[model samples]
Target: MAGTATHHGIPLRSGSGLSYRFDPGALGFELLPTGGPDWMARYEVLHTPEDLRRWVGQSRLDPTPEPEIGAEDVPAARALRDALWRIGLARVAGEGPADADLATLNAAAARPPLVPVIGQDGAAGWAAPATGAQVLSTVARDAIAVLTGPYADRIRICSGDNCALMYVDTSRPGRRRWCAMENCGNRHKVRAHRARQSGE
Candidate 1:
């Protein structure tokens, strides 16, 4: 199925529109789709430390004790995002993941992810005290899980026009085309309608 519906409008051009959605498939693939055909104008969602913080917070992987993201974490976060993108693309192509990308991911995975904490009331919760690296590690580990698991075969790139995002096809029919119906599906539909009218 497509992602949750939102009112975010579509931009015909690349690197202008920014839509964020969480798919039930994988977390690592979510880092992509910020930019499109234009590499230069590609809008990076996590452009600042605060953006990283918001992304992680919204992820809900480690909610409490929000890790203080600093300038140093931004580059690492970007690098990790790129690495995951490359790995995801390779998975979709039925090709081996790049050795360098694997190495980078492995290194990130080596770091400890969020650990569960038991409250005094016996209620359990998870937290990553070292937010920066731990959060990034968590994302890397998620990618690793997806890439190595059976779902890796379901990896698909969105077929939306000018949309270059990867997603895991978890539908029953396994024929999901766009990442989200509200995001690109509607745009495709409108464009097709315009074409039909123009042709007639």
Candidate 2:
């Protein structure tokens, strides 16, 4: 169901005040925009336990796991997300993921993931009061699946200039480009129009 859905809607706002939904196409790649290591620290959004909780709610995790996020979970999430960023980029470049990053993912995946159960209403649900570790574990496991799955070769960096968002191109023709057509794709169209007008 949720996991098998073609896209997960992540609400985002652009510098120009445009709001749009970004579908990174997988649970793990969704973590990358929260922040990363080194220069990416500027984009840091996982500031508090609540912040992490909020993100989990916003994430594609079906029947979202209400993990008891702690202060320590914050840094751990950032670390995992940064590692994922490196791994994703490496895949895009046709290079192997680094050992260190692989180790990080493996360690997280070793932990028990969020427990799922069917509710009385037959709706999907997660075991109550999950741990932060479980949340990370779930994300790591998802990453592992995508990395080793058929679409692994379809991972791509957005073609928009100055945009570094990564997404798995799951289109049947595999010709999908841009993070979102309404966002980067439309921007490219506008730029081309302006250039044409200038040349006239």
For all candidates, the clash counts are 0, 0
- Where does candidate 2 have its weakest 10-residue lDDT segment? 1-10
* lDDT (Cα, tens digit) per residue for candidate 1, span 1-200: 01112322222233345554535366665555443223723566767889788766555354566776788887787777777777777777788888887888888888877666766775545554546887778778878887878787889888987667678887888889987776677778999999999999
> Which pairs clash in model 1?
none
Q: Estimate each model's TM-score.
A: 0.77, 0.92
The prediction achieving the highest lDDT against the true structure is 2
Residues 16-130, candidate 2, lDDT per residue (tens digit)?
8899888888888888878787777888899999988888877787634467889998888988999999999888888998999999999999999888877667667678878
* RMSD, one per candidate, in order: 5.2, 2.0
Give the total clashing residue pairs for model 1.
Answer: 0
